[model samples]
Target: MPANLTPQYHKAEEVYKQAKTSEEKIAALEEMLRAMPKHKGTDHLQADLKRRIAKLREEESRPKSKKAAFDPFRVEKGGAGQVLLLGAPNAGKSAIVARLTSAPTQPTPFPFATQGPIPGMMAHEDVQVQLVDLPPITPDYFPSGMLGLVKSADGALLVADLSSDLVLDDLETILAKVSEGRVRLFDPAVQTAGAPADSDEVLLVRIPALLLANKGDADGAQDRLELLRELYQGRFDPLVISAETQEGLDRLPGAVFGMLKRIRIYSKEPGKPVDRSSPFVLKEGDTVLDLAARIHRDFPEHLKQARVWGSARFEGQAVQRDYVLRDRDVVELQVDL
Candidate 1:
């Protein structure tokens, strides 16, 4: 029997061939399985893929040696969401990250000062968003496993150096490289209308991205901004900011948090005051039942109703399990004992 595969499966196979890490391989294999024709002819192939998946998962679970090789690309996710800081050499990614998170970034008057991924926590109101300063990417300096990291991230912040004349060239290269990796950068407003119909040739990981035109305080920065607008022309309306002067940064934390499409909820006891310090971050459209489940594994089984504070018709109004949550909504769960 001939195993006639679809174009999507072939595309995934190419990705699998190029995969450098177990995570990337597993992702590709899963895609392949999803796109493969479900017929007796593909039975052997299906079993083979399953076996490969199991093997990769086992390898992932296996403990690493203390003396094992360090993976500069691997960054374990932390905080509410992980956002990657991508840019060309000396594009001021490190400086912006330092300003946002107060993390140490030893700035040198040189390119490639950052050697690997530097993870920092940027506080957005009550929640912390992880901003990773990835090593500078250029046509000649794209590190291995970079795309995998980008694909795994919640969002991205691409910084462009307004102080440099060759900023456009660098930006062009950065965009091209990510596109080749099948990662599409959306401005958050775009692509939320509806996901692209799943196609055989396209399996893009669409991410909400914001372009920051750095060094807005520098001379000729405004001219450079105009040029960028003309060059990319409607494709990007870059956010202007000065990492050195901290101008136009008052809304940056909120902007990044908005990209995650997340809402912070305050869980409360029936008679106790809500703890506004630490919020239970939930998806923007998550329900009261979702919050109950997050509170405890067995909560949904006993969930009866909830009292709302923020989005209720009136204060302390009793809502059903399916009531949608809004940001900062104080939810008092009433689960049967």
Candidate 2:
């Protein structure tokens, strides 16, 4: 099938040509992917774009010289999903991560206290999600590799200081900077549906983001949050929290999990009990065949039938290979060895 590429994709291609940094190139490629039509005709093109994005990300995450400073931006993804904490200087991004995860953090009063990305795992009920606290994104000081890190994240928490009068402006600056790099923040209203299958116009990389209004206990903080909602209600929703006092922090893990849009599936042996402690994490809409393939590369082909414990009509109910699995579903694949 011929890829009937659109004008938007070609325009992004031109931007890719003019891009000076890897971050800008990645943004352009992501835009191209978003603008390209989602169909069999463009499968090869889409695959190529994705490959290029991955290659660029890998290269950017590596260190350039042995004598150069340690690449603090390089973070290996772990757990159910990877989320990045993004905000202006002294916006409490590191404080939030330190409070939520076991990662060592120095929460100083000075701006730019965090010069590199520090990763920690946030526990949510039975599963854990990886959270990386990154350097502040200021007008004059943003790491050239920041966009690559942002593109690798499954979601983002846009932290802002509710006590500061410049909070709104700070948020706007972060948004504008990221947009200029081609990584558009996700807005549910504007991106309610995916691009039309027949249409060649691609959409930009719209990452689901939650605005964190930190220092909520400070004076006039509530008013700042109100103003923020008033000005950017349609663009993003703000979650008020105080990392210092740990107020409203209890709900943050669940919120991050919800934004990840992932499902957990537990595996069980044919005659053994299910291992509920560790789960195989997969995106939503995964099937039994997909689970089988995850278990073993040959399981998908040698599979006969499977028994599902959760989201089934009955416990241990026999299901076909194509049975769609749900979150926390216990699966037992009876494959022909």
- lDDT tens string, model 2, 114-218? 888899999998899999998899888777578767766788999989989999889888998887765667644324424433222232455778888899999
> In model 2, how large is the Cα lDDT of residue 29?
90
Q: lDDT tens digits, residues 97-137, model 1?
A: 88888667776679889998889999987899999998888
Residue pair clashes in candidate 1: none
- Please give the range of 10 consecutive residues that has the lowest summed lDDT in model 1: 193-202
Cα-based TM-score, every candidate: 0.79, 0.80
lDDT of each: 0.82, 0.82
Native RMSD of candidate 1 (Å)? 7.4
Any runs in candidate 2 off by more than 4 Å, and if so which? 1-71, 187-203
Candidate 1 residue runs with Cα over 4 Å from true position = 1-69, 190-194
**How far does residue 61 in candidate 2 sit from its true spot (Å)?**
7.9
Backbone clashes in each candidate structure, one number apiece?
0, 6
